[model samples]
Target: MTTARRKPYGVKGAPYAFLLPATVLFSSFFALPIGYAVWLSFHKVHVFGLGLGKGARSEVWAGVENYTDALTDSELLDGALRVLGYGCIVVPVMLGLALLFALMLDAEKVRLAPFTRLAIFLPYAVPGVVAALLWGFLYLPDVSPFSFVLEKLGLPQPDLLDGGPLYLALSNIAVWGGTGFNMIVIYTSLRAVPAEVYEAAKLDGATPLQIALRIKIPMVASSLVLTFFFSIIATLQVFNEPTTLKPLTNSVSTTWSPLMKVYRDAFGTGDIHQAAAEAVIIALATLVLSFGFLRAANRRDKQEAAG
Candidate 1:
């Protein structure tokens, strides 16, 4: 009986025991915060007319009031649209640059690959705020080499801090900061592709372009999917870049992204309940979008595998 009872606690269970600390931390930090956020999202405070005494305020069930408010908020919706526009530029440009750098690095005759790779990726080590600050300085007319050059050539100086140009400025920061990581992801996957695959394509009289497009890219689809997923999530949570840029420009508001709006609402405006509700909605939307993209990617992968 003792031996039989002890079987469950053998090597198999030992790993779980080792993981107990991590599980506890997850429950305490991640799980609890998420649960509390959801709970708080559904409640609001009601204050009496006098609004004087402590007991004058009471928590009341708000049901979907906050959710509806968040959804209907023009500021948040505009922020969402702004982020979407920024993402349109950031996602493609960043990933394209990443893919280009990866391909260049993977090439047999590329020069300075190591130096370029490190230089490009070094921005990732810099905090987002610091990166924004650094880039912000570089964008300033007094400090920018580009502006100096344009001035020398007597060309019209473009305003980068306002209107549509601001999107480009913000997108550039994200692209510069993110490209190296995505490049590494793509490059690692590229490295993992067997030499035999390339040799086989070569033997088949396939040109390098044909080999890259037909075989190399298709093989690294999984990595691309992963990068795309993470990039989209990061795009949705864009906060630091705009916030940092705010000191230098008046275009950026307190609510520059949906997440930023939620933050502003919760802390800035003292509306945690509304912020919580907005947060839940954003989380749900993100999950739905992510899962949908993942499912589509999986389907495409299966089809490619079958073919």
Candidate 2:
């Protein structure tokens, strides 16, 4: 027999209906938090005389006071500069190693490729906090393998957890923890290059380096751009690594990085308003930098295509 007739717009309703749950979840977790942070950014607490009663401590509208304070705060500025330096080291080194490893994997007669790939990617499975903890301990002179070898050879053991080396020390953790994931991304795209393309390049008497530099790299440019975009964001949002390392090192202040400073302000100092302003600033910076990178990459791709 008989079947019920569907509504005319039911076809359209079906997709949105399926997406409703995800939309709700995204709103709840991401959108609401952002909105609330923004709302809190424009308010502050009021303290009357005596400051000892519930009525004495009241919430009041701050009127951009928090934003002004955040912008002028030397600690926040220092944290931002520190993070910039850290990101400068992390982004290039991680992406470079990723591209290098990916190209190596794409090479002929590569040994232990499957095993090497799995090994390299294994760290990606580790949580960033856990990875930082593991690497933090390894940076300790008494516990580090490098320091152990140096000690055996009667050489001076340098402190990795402090001073100028602190940048590289923090950077190494980010690089090690991130390289594997970026490598796999670049390698997967590298593998997707057409076999015919390589054959054509070979027919033209191009060496492997030429094929990679000219063909594979060009073909994989989109993937490189995507990876670099994500890597830059990750470098900017570097909180877990530096925060985890703080317990073991003194150089890392309560405001070591911008995100860490936000965390400290919001939770540590119980000032969500100032933190919110800083958070919004960071989010904007991320969007600007990421969009700029994508445009630059696209321009290069177009140039390559035209040439």
Q: Which ten residues in a row have the lowest lDDT in candidate 2?
A: 5-14
lDDT of 2 by residue, 71-136 (tens): 899998898899889988988999999998999999999999999999888888899889889988
| Pairs in clash, predicted candidate 1 | none
RMSD of each candidate relative to the true structure: 2.6, 2.5
What TM-score quantifies how close candidate 1 is to the native fold? 0.93
Clashing pairs in 2: none
For each candidate in the order shown, give its overall lDDT on alpha carbons: 0.90, 0.89
Model 2 off-target regions past 4 Å? 1-12, 303-307
